[model samples]
Target: MLSRTADHLYWMSRYTERAENTARMLNVSYETSMLPQSASAATKAWQSVLSISELLPAYYQRHDEVTLEGVLHFMVRDETNSSSIYSCLQAARENARAVRGALTTEAWETQNLTWLDMNRLFKAKKFETDPAKFFEWVKYRSHLSRGVALGTMLQDDAFRFLRLGTFIERADNTARLLDVRFHAIKNDYHGTVPGKGQAQFDFYHWSAILRSVSAFEVYRKVYRNVITPERVAEMLILRRDMPRSLHASMYEVVQILEAVANDHSAETQRQAGLLLAELQYGRIDELLATGLHAYLVHFLERVHALGGRIGSDFLATADM
Candidate 1:
């Protein structure tokens, strides 16, 4: 495959996944913000979304304060915010258009139609009236796009690259979401004792975290008990059986890197393998003992470094 084609295919998949993940993060914040909380608490929840995406500076430059209305508009429909859902879907469509030949007819149509439908929604100001419903639409469209690609596209390097992009984005988002939510939950209980109210508080926040990743039911089935922070972290960060878990994403990353290996991709493969090993053998107890926030920060740094390696090894032309 041409380097440019590969780049487009890879980024098309990433941007689509990014749109869905952004919706997921925002949805969690939206849901929690509806609950009874202090004004400062609510503001911090909204701010965490920006922090997770590394967009705080951009957000502050545009807005004087972190109001719910301002943050929602900035995240959902702001075209200038590159990480906004609008920009991500736009980028996804542009990349898909550039490599229509590499995509199946169904996949290309799905990508194009998603963009068109999103524009219509924006024109109708759908996000302003019902942001949750707007987010659900974005997630469903992303699901449809991935399903069509997997079902219609050939299982070749192009497909591998697409899958690769999806998992890489998933892994990073999962880690960020978990880290921020867990920290908030911890802070909420800083001076509280273990009691029924604390249990209820933990349940509400932890379940919100699970639902953000679409793993609430999975948590119920896998653990078959009350939701606890340790178990929640374990399920999201270590459990290989859970589809959106870090371990599972890394497993896919390792396998896909091996499948699409090139002469220059050895270092990329090795780094991916090392990351996978850390997840595969890692225990949640140890992670929480040391500090989940610190652990996740390190993991994000490694994921960023691995992304840089992938670009240098195979997607260098993306910069051009």
Candidate 2:
């Protein structure tokens, strides 16, 4: 494939996945804020959403404070925010258009239609009163786009690139979510068992974290125990069975890269394999001992580095 086409295919999928995950983060924050928390707690939770999205700096540039309305507008509607859902979908659609022939008819139509519908929602200001519904719509459209591609597109290099984008984006998001919540609760739970109130507080926050990644039920089924910080981290970070887990995403990425391997893929493959093996063999206790925040920060850096290597190896071209 042409480097430009490969770049478009890869980024189109990444932006789509990013849009859905942004909605997931917003939904989690909105739901948690309604749980009768203190004003400071609510503000902190909202701020974490921006921080996890890596948009806190950009957000502060345009806004004075993190009000719910302001954050929602900045995250979902601000065209200037490149990582916003609006911008993600717009970029996805434009990339899809650029590589129109590389995509199946269903895939192209889904991308185009999602953009059109999003524009309508933006003009109608539908999210002002019904943000939850708006988030659901964004997630649903993303799912539709993915399903169309997986069900209709040929299982070739293009499909591999698409999957690579989805899983890389997912891995980064999952790591960020886990890291943010881990930091929030680290000091709260020293060595002592949490009191009843503290336990409930932990449960609520951890449950919200799992639900953000669609892992609440999986956590329940797999652990069948109370939601502790460590177990939540383990499930989201290391459990290969959990679809959105960091381990699962890295596993998929490694496999896809292997499938599409070329002479230039050695470094990308090596980095991906090392990351996946670390997650595959890692222990929750060891991770906690190492400082979960530090570990996660290192992981995020590695993921970012791997992304850059992949771009250089497979998608490097001036036109792209």
Kindly give the number of clashing pairs for every candidate. 0, 0
Which tens-of-lDDT digit does each residue in 1-320 have in candidate 2? 77778889999999999999999999988877888767776777778889898888999999998888889899999989999999999999999999999999999999999999999997898888789999999999999998999999999999889999999999999999888877866653444445777777778888999999999999999999888888998999999999999999999999999998989889889999999999999999999998889999999999999998889888844222
lDDT of 1 by residue, 176-206 (tens): 9888777766775544746777677778888
Clashing pairs in 1: none
Global lDDT scores for all candidate models: 0.88, 0.89
* Residue pairs that clash (backbone atoms under 3 angstroms), model 2: none
Q: What TM-score does each of the candidates earn?
A: 0.96, 0.96
Worst lDDT run of 10 residues, candidate 2, spans 185-194
